[model samples]
Target: MKYSKIFQYAYIVFAVLFIYDAISKYMSNGDIYYPSILLAALAIFIFFFRKRFSKKFDNRDNSK
Candidate 1:
């Protein structure tokens, strides 16, 4: 559970970083960086996925 929370927050951090990277690349090069976009997408997916699990864990804890 602790590790899950860590990974959930990590995903959010990675998502932010990837999005920043994408924007910076676009600003500097006037072109969309596909790799950064893909990474951002994956990071968002993981963030949401872990969020769901975290919510479930919280619910379980509260019910105990």
Candidate 2:
């Protein structure tokens, strides 16, 4: 569980890195970097999704 929590925050860190890379590329040549943007979005979505899933798992365990 401790490692899982760490990985969850790692997703956000990766998302920020992806977003920064996308912005830097755009600034350099004025073209949209779709893949980086997509990856960042996916990372953010996964972070929230995993958090919700973990909460549900914890609740189920507590109920049992």
TM-score of each predicted structure versus truth: 0.77, 0.95
Where model 2 places Cα greater than 4 Å from the true spot, the runs are none
TM-score, structure 2 vs. true: 0.95
Candidate 1 global lDDT? 0.89
RMSD of candidate 1 to the truth, in angstroms, is: 1.9
* Model 2 per-residue lDDT tens digits across residues 1-64: 8888899999999999999999999999999999999999999999999999989988999999
Q: Which one wins on lDDT?
A: 2
Q: Write model 1 residue lDDT over 7-42, tens digit each, in one string.
A: 778987888899999999999999999898899899
lDDT of 1 at 9: 84
For model 1, where is the 10-residue window of minimal lDDT?
1-10
Model 1 stretches with alpha carbons more than 4 Å out: 57-64
